[model samples]
Each structure stands twice: as structure tokens, then as C-alpha cells.
Target: MSAGDIILIPNRSDNYIYLLRCAKSGVTAVIDPGDAAPVIDELEKRGWQLDIILNTHHHNDHVGGNAELKEKYGAKIIGPTAEADKIGGLDVTVAEGDTVKVGELEASIYDVPGHTAGHIAFYFPAVSALFSGDSLFALGCGRLFEGTAEQMWHSLIKFRTLPVETRLYCGHEYTLNNARFALTIEPENTALQARVSAIETLRKANRPTIPSTIGEEIDTNPFLRADVPLVGKAMGMSGATAEIVFTEIRHRKDNF
Candidate 1:
């Protein structure tokens, strides 16, 4: 029932590896360990044993270290039920509404299929944190790799329903580029303009612009602002349905 310590590990290019450690129980879990060397090294450095390997999808970059980590630490592997066969060393398959526990921390699983048909997210209500994988990002959303714009929109809507204080930990460090693209969609949005400025400063210092709060994304992320009048007007789709506006924005991003 307590919040955990999260270690953000920058992995292979733009990917991220999150190491969650329960402060109360000293239990540790590796979320999306695309590479095992760093996770293993960090675990040893902290004298923490790996107890869980949690995957949001079966993408190679996300699960590439699954087998090695599981075999090395005897950690139980958990992944999306829809992608169980595709993910290596999976011991448990979960879907929306299911729950996973890491020591005293309990996280709710969410089916956020869009980046991939079986993509999912993990939400730790106790910590007000969401491991959104690649489904949602700062100032942007994942591409419809195996799903449609409508599906991605629905997935985003599901995330938006979480508490505004919920902080999202996305899979990639694409915020700088996403912020630039978002400006094109909502150039007049003051929140977005300010966020872009802040993002530039952070990136210049090589800092991560992640763990963005739902409230911040709601106010600044173009992908999440499709329903706003200004966003719709910019796309020449004023009064358009959220789905339609989202689709247009997604399409434009594909070309952007």
C-alpha cells in the first residue's frame, strides 16, 4: 500500500527501463528491461534482488532482456495475455482490470492496445503513477502500429480518466521532438508554448522530460487536446468529434 522508488534507466537509443523498488519490503521489479546488463548492474549495486519482470508488450526492444533476466534472477515474468506467446519467459498473463503486486505496492493493469494490438499499461494508484509503455507520451501518443487511430484514441481516453495527479512514465524519450510537433497543432496554446520552453531547457541539460502529470498532458499535449476548440479549429475540423480530430492529428504526425 506504499509508493515505491522508481529508477529510470535510459536504454538502447530512446527506450527506458524502469526499476521499481518497494521501500517497505525491499522487493524490486524491472519494467521493460530491453537490456539486462544495466538492470542487473543496478540491482547488484543496490543489493536488491529482482523479483518481477513486467512487460507492457512483446516488442523486441521491450522484451529483449526478458529471458536473460528471468533466468538469472528467477524473477516471475508478467505480460499482456494477448501477447503471452510472443513475449519470452512469461509466467503470468494479464489484461485490463487485473492487478499485479510488487511487495507492498499494488498496480492495476490497463489494456492500452494501440502501439501494438496487445499493448498494455500499469497504473499504481497508491503512487499515482502510470507506466504507459508506448501507448501515450509527453505531447504525443504512439503510432498505430497494429491498431487504428480510433483504437489509440480510445486507449488515450481510458488514460485520461485516471486522476489528474497521475504521473505518466512513457517508454521512450521522445518529448523534445513531440513538443516541436505539438506546436504546429496548437501554436497559440499558452500551456503548450511554456511546456516547449521548459522541455528545451531540460533537454539541453540532458535531463529527462518524462513522468509528466495527466494534468500537464491534458493542458499541453496535442494528442490529448483533440477535443479542445482551438485544436479542432487548427485542423479545420472545428466541432468535430474527438475521434475524428484525433485521427487527423495522428495522420499529420505520421507525415510530420
Candidate 2:
């Protein structure tokens, strides 16, 4: 299958809505439509019709446009099975191990519950794209809103196992803040420092620093590096388990 074209649509402060078009089948889908206006505008601009609405969670910023988009284009609303009630207008409720098809492209669903109880992510290995929503970010992870640190840690671990080159498409544009917080954790990390510099340049130009690869996050994101001895040592928990180290990192980020 040919790789699909992914377009970034910025809306509602920092929220990101992705419009994807399958190259081979010409099928179109929107991932996490935080607002209908932007999604509708993009679709109309491209002369494309929406076929599917993929929601990662029930957060307002993620599913707020579901009803409108569905009503307008008769798009199929596919969302997490656990939050089917919370996410109204869901045409298909999916869980881990299920596969969702967007035209000729197929995505593997992962039950990534941390930012929200029913949070999930879609991974299209063929294209090396992961629509992570709020579960993971460019240089950070989402806050533990409705889940525990342990749950969030495990959820991140799932992402860590993906191919190093997998492109992560998260829900928000929090990379600048996340990069600053990450510097506080690993000031000595040259890789992190360089990434911070690049991120600074991107933010200065008001460009999105998103679609960060898994390998980039592994080398720089403090949350994803909780298992590294350097990260644990920096937190004064060198001998502690990864979960314990991760909890501390999350706590500090909450206040940072």
C-alpha cells in the first residue's frame, strides 16, 4: 500500500487535527478533530470528502468535532470502546488488537489509557505513522489526568516498543514547553540540548514541531527515558524501578 498524505490542521489554541488521505484508494479520514470548522475548511479546500473520524479519547479537544463532521459528511465515527458512552456518535467502538482501515491503509489500535481512562492510539506501520493523541507528545507525555503514574508509565512503554522511525502525531503543540522541562531534567544531554535548539527555532517561526519520531523521543524525551540510569540518577532515584522514576518525572512536570 502507498503511504497516505497527512496534513496538519491547527485549531483551538494548541490542539492539532490531522487530515489523512490514502494515496492508493483516495479515502480520506480525520484524526482528532478538535473543531469542525478547521477540519471542514481543510476538506473543502482539498476538494476531499471525509470518510472516517478517528478519535483517540473522549476529551473535548479530541472529539469536539465528531458530531458536526459526522453529520455533515456521514463520516464513520471510530473511537475507543471504553469511552463509547462518553464519545457520542461513535459508529464503531474499537479496542486493543483491533484493526481499522482507512481506504487501503490499515492501522493497529493500541489501548493507551493514561491521559484519559479510555485513551487509545492508532499505528499504521506501513506508513510508520502513529496517531498518538494525548497519550504521548513530541518531547513529553500527557499529564496523568484520569489515570495513575503507573498506568501512564505502562502506556508509554507500549509506545517505546514501536519502530524507532515511527512518526508520532500527538494531540497538541506542547513541544516548546516540553523541551524546556526536558532540559531541566537532562541538562548534560547533548542530544537533548541540540533538539531544544531546533525546537526553539521552530517555535520562533510559529511552525509545528510535531510528528517527532520515536527514536527522537527516546533520545531526548525525559518521560520516555525514565528507565535510563542517567534519568533515574538525575532524579535521585538511581536504584528505583522505572515506574518510580517515571512517577517522579511526571510530578515534576506537573509543577514545571
Per-residue lDDT of 53-156 in model 2, one digit per residue for the tens?
99999999999999999999999999999999999999999999999999988999999888999999999987889999999999899988899999998998
- Highest lDDT: which candidate? 2
Model 2 alpha-carbon drift over 4 Å, by segment:
none
TM-score of candidate 1 on Cα atoms, chains taken together? 0.97
Cα miss at 191, model 2 (Å)?
A: 0.6
lDDT of 1 by residue, 216-244 (tens): 99998888888888889987898899999
TM-score of candidate 2 versus the correct structure, residues matched by position: 0.98
Instruction: Spell out the clash pairs found in candidate 2.
Output: none
> Which predicted model would earn the best TM-score?
2
